[model samples]
Target: DQQVKQNSPSLSVQEGRISILNCDYTNSMFDYFLWYKKYPAEGPTFLISISSIKDKNEDGRFTVFLNKSAKHLSLHIVPSQPGDSAVYFCAASVHAGGTSYGKLTFGQGTILTVHP
Candidate 1:
C-alpha cells in the first residue's frame, strides 16, 4: 500500500498563475511532513515542511497546509514561474524514534508544467 500518495501525475499552468499540489497519507503515526522540488539532473530540494503539531507553514512564495483530521496536505505556489516547472514530491516521516532517523516515504511525484 502507498503510505503517501500524490494523485495527480502532472499539472499544467500558465506563468504567474497559482500552482497547487495535493498529497494524502494513510498513516496516523506520521508526525512530520515535507515537500521537495526536483529538477532534471539535480537532487530534490526541500521546499517546505510542517509538523503534526501545526496546521500550516509558509516561506516566501511557497506555503504548505496540513489538515490532520483529513490526512491531507497541499503545497501552494503563488505566481508560479517557468523555473518552477519540475517534479514535486510529498514525504512523510515518523519522529517517535530518537535522533529523527526515520526515512522519508515519498509520493510518486507530480510534474508541474508552467507555460510562459
Candidate 2:
C-alpha cells in the first residue's frame, strides 16, 4: 500500500501569491519528511525538510510544516514565481540510528504551476 499520498494532483498560483502544497502519510513509523521539486527534464531536487520533532522548518522563501498527530505535512512558498513551478514530491522515512538512508518512501508528485 502507498503510505504517502498527495491528494491534489496539481495546484495553480499567481506570482507573488502564497502557494501551499499538502501531503499525508499513513505510516506511523515515518519520522522524517522531505520535499523535492523537479523541473521538466531534470531530477527532483531537495527543497525543504522537517523532522517529526519539529512542527515547522523554514528556509528563505520555502517552509515545511509537519503535524505528527495528523500524519500530515505541507510545503508553503511565499510569493510564488514562474521558476517555482514544478512537480513537488513528498517523501517520508523512519530515522534509525541517526540515519534515514535506504528507507525513504515517496508519494506521487503534485504539479505546481505559478503564473506570472
Candidate 3:
C-alpha cells in the first residue's frame, strides 16, 4: 500500500492568486513532513517542511500545515505566479536514530499551473 498520496493530479490558478495542494499519509510513524517543487527534467527542490510537533511552518510565500491526528498535510502558496507552475510533492520520513540517510517517501505529486 502506498504510504503517501496526493489526491489531486493537477490544479490551475491565476497569477497573483492562492494555490493549495493537499496530501495524505497512512503511516503514523512519519514525523517529518516536507513539500517539494519540481520542474520538467529537473530534480525536486525542497520547499518547506513541518515536524510532527508543529502544526504549521512557513517560508516566504510558501506555507505547510500538518495535522498529525488526521495524517494529512497541505501546502499553500500565496499570490501564485507563473514561476510557481510545477509539480508539487509531499514527502514523509522517519528520522530513526538521527541517521535518516536522507530517505523520503514521496506522494504521487500534484501539478500546479499558474496562469498569467
Candidate 4:
C-alpha cells in the first residue's frame, strides 16, 4: 500500500509563476522527508526537504512546509521556469528506535509543466 500520495497528476504554469505541489501521508510514523525532481533522462535528485520537528524548510526559490497534525505537506516553487518543468515526487521516511533509517517511501509524482 502507498503510504504517501500526490493527488495532483499534473500541473501547468507560466514562467515566473509560483508552482505549488501538495502531498499527503497516511502513516503517522513518517518523520523524515524529501522532494525529488527528475528531468528527462536524468535520475531523480533531491530538491528540498523538511524535518518533522520543523514546519517549514526553504532553500532559495523552493520551500517545503509540513503540517504534522494534518499529515500533509506542500512544496512551493517561486518564479517557475521552463527548466523547472519536470516530475516532482514527495517522499518520506520513518525515524524510530534512536536511529534514522534512510528508507524512503515515495508518492506517485506530479508532472509540472512550466511554459515560457
Candidate 5:
C-alpha cells in the first residue's frame, strides 16, 4: 500500500485565484511534512513545510496545513498565477534526528493548472 496518496490527479484555477491541493498518508511516525513543486523538465523545488508539532505553516502565498490526528495535509496557494501551474508532491519523513537521514515518502503528485 502507498504510504501517501493524492486523490485528486489535477486541479484547475483561474489566474489570481486560490488553489487547494490535498494529500493523505498512513504513516504516523512521520514528523515532518513538506511540499515540493515541479515544472516540466525540471526537478522539484521545495515550496513549504510544517512539522508535526505545528498545525500550520505559511510563507508568502503558500500555506501548508497538517492534521496529525487525521493523517492528512493540504497545501493552499492564494492568488494563484499562471506560472504556478505545476505538479505538487506531498512528502513526509520521520526525522530520526542525530544526523540520521530518514527516507521520505511522497504522495503521487497533484497537477495544478493555473489558467491566465
Candidate 6:
C-alpha cells in the first residue's frame, strides 16, 4: 500500500509569516521525498526534495526536513506571500525493479492560504 498522508486539509497564515506543512508515509521503502506547489488548475510544480539518507534540504525561501525513523516530513516557507496561496502536495517515490523507473505516490494535498 503506497499511502502518503497529509492530515491537514488546509492552513491559513499571514503574509511575512512562516508557513509549515506536514506529511506522513506508511510505506517504508520510499527513498525519495518531494514537495510540490500547485495553483488552481495547473499541475503541481516541483518545489524541493530530500533523499532518505539526508535529514533536510533547503532551497531559497523553502525548506524540507525529513525524519525516516518517524516516517514524517515537513515543508517550511519563510516570509510567506499572498501570491503563495495554493495547494501543496507531498509525494514519495522509489526506484522500481525492472524498467518501470520511478513512480510517485502523492498525498491528498494541503491547501494553504497566505493572507495579506
Which residue ranges in model 1 land beyond 4 Å of their true spot? Answer: 98-100
Which candidate wins on lDDT? 1
Q: How do the predictions measure up, each by TM-score? A: 0.95, 0.94, 0.95, 0.94, 0.95, 0.94
Question: For each candidate, what is the lDDT?
Answer: 0.96, 0.94, 0.94, 0.94, 0.94, 0.94
Model 6 quality (TM-score): 0.94
Question: Any runs in candidate 4 off by more than 4 Å, and if so which?
Answer: 97-100
Q: Report the lDDT tens digits of candidate 3 across residue range 1-116.
A: 89999999999999999999999999998989999999999999989999999999989999999988899999999989999999999999986766765679999999999999
RMSD of each: 1.5, 1.9, 1.5, 1.7, 1.7, 1.3
| Candidate 4 clash pair list | none
lDDT of model 1 at position 20: 97
TM-score, candidate number 1 = 0.95
CA lDDT, candidate 4, residue 116? 92
Better of 3 and 6 by lDDT: 3
Q: Tens digit of lDDT per residue, candidate 6, span 39-63? A: 9879999999999999999999999
Model 1 — which ten-residue stretch has the worst lDDT? 94-103
Query: TM-score of model 5 relative to the true fold?
Result: 0.95
lDDT of 5 at 108: 87
- Model 3 residue 87 distance off true place after TM-score fit, in angstroms: 0.4
**lDDT tens readout by residue for model 5, 1-116:** 99999999999999998999999999888899999999999999999999999999999999999998999999999989999999999999989975437778899899999999
Which residue pairs in candidate 6 have backbone atoms (N, alpha carbon, C) closer than 3 angstroms, thus clashing?
none
Q: Per-residue error at 109 for model 6, in Å?
A: 0.4
- Model 2 residue 81 CA deviation (Å) reads 0.7
The predicted structure with the larger lDDT, 1 or 6, is: 1
| Runs off by more than 4 Å, candidate 6 | none
Using alpha carbons, what is the TM-score of model 4?
A: 0.94
